[model samples]
Structures are given as structure tokens and as C-alpha cells.
Target: MPHLEEHVSLRPYNTFGLAVQARYFARFTSAEVLRQLLALPEV
Candidate 1:
């Protein structure tokens, strides 16, 4: 991952097209990093 914190937000999403931030949030450049990101407590 270039940066794990990229695109993360505490602000209310300005759209109703999605469910929630954490519900669809993810950041990783590879499967290995994806596994690590999915394990995060905040994921």
C-alpha cells in the first residue's frame, strides 16, 4: 500500500449512493497488504 490512511475519513460522506465508509473502505496495492489492511481494527 502506498498509504494506509489515504481516503479514510471521519466526516459524514456527502452521498447516499453508498452504505458506509468502513463498510467499503480499503487500501492496499497487493493481496498481502490487503490481508493486513483487512485485519486492522478500524477496517
Candidate 2:
């Protein structure tokens, strides 16, 4: 499974540096991996 993370902060990713949270966060290397992650219930 992809390295799934919940409630991940978006501050570093944000250009404005605002404290935002993502309900779910994951990085996929390929389309198949992305499909797998998207298949998860939480996604």
C-alpha cells in the first residue's frame, strides 16, 4: 500500500504558508499505485 497519511499539514506545501490540513495524503509512483490508493475507503 502507499504510505497513507491522515490530517497532514499543508503549510510547507502552501505558497502562502497557511496552516491547512488534508484529510488524507498519499504519494503514488505510478498510475496503478494511484488507482490502488484511490480504491481505499478513506480516499
Candidate 3:
């Protein structure tokens, strides 16, 4: 599996000073949306 860092960076955009950011980030209002995102190949 590809490492998350390979696709994302936290050096500039991260406000919390975390070591990394999600290569792909999303917010879901419901379970169905979460499932859909999880099913995407790019994710």
C-alpha cells in the first residue's frame, strides 16, 4: 500500500502542527457518503 505522506504534506497547510495531512480528506454528514468515499479507487 502507498504511504500517506507520499500523497500529502503538512508543512504548509496544517494549522495544528501535525506531522502530516491527508492526501485526500473529506467530511461526511452521513454514513452513505463516508462509504462512497471509502469505495473510491483514488482514496
Highest lDDT model number:
2
- Local accuracy of candidate 1 as per-residue lDDT tens digits, 1-43: 4345644553565564553444345546788888877777665
TM-score, structure 2 vs. true:
0.85
- Residue runs of model 1 more than 4 Å from their true location after superposition: 6-26
Worst 10 residues of 1 by lDDT: 1-10
Candidate 1 global TM-score: 0.39
Estimated TM-score for each candidate: 0.39, 0.85, 0.49
Residue 35, model 2: lDDT of 92
Off by over 4 Å in 3: 1-19
lDDT of 2 by residue, 16-41 (tens): 99999999988788999999998888
> Compared with the true structure, what per-residue lDDT tens digits does model 3 show for residues 16-35?
77777566756577777777
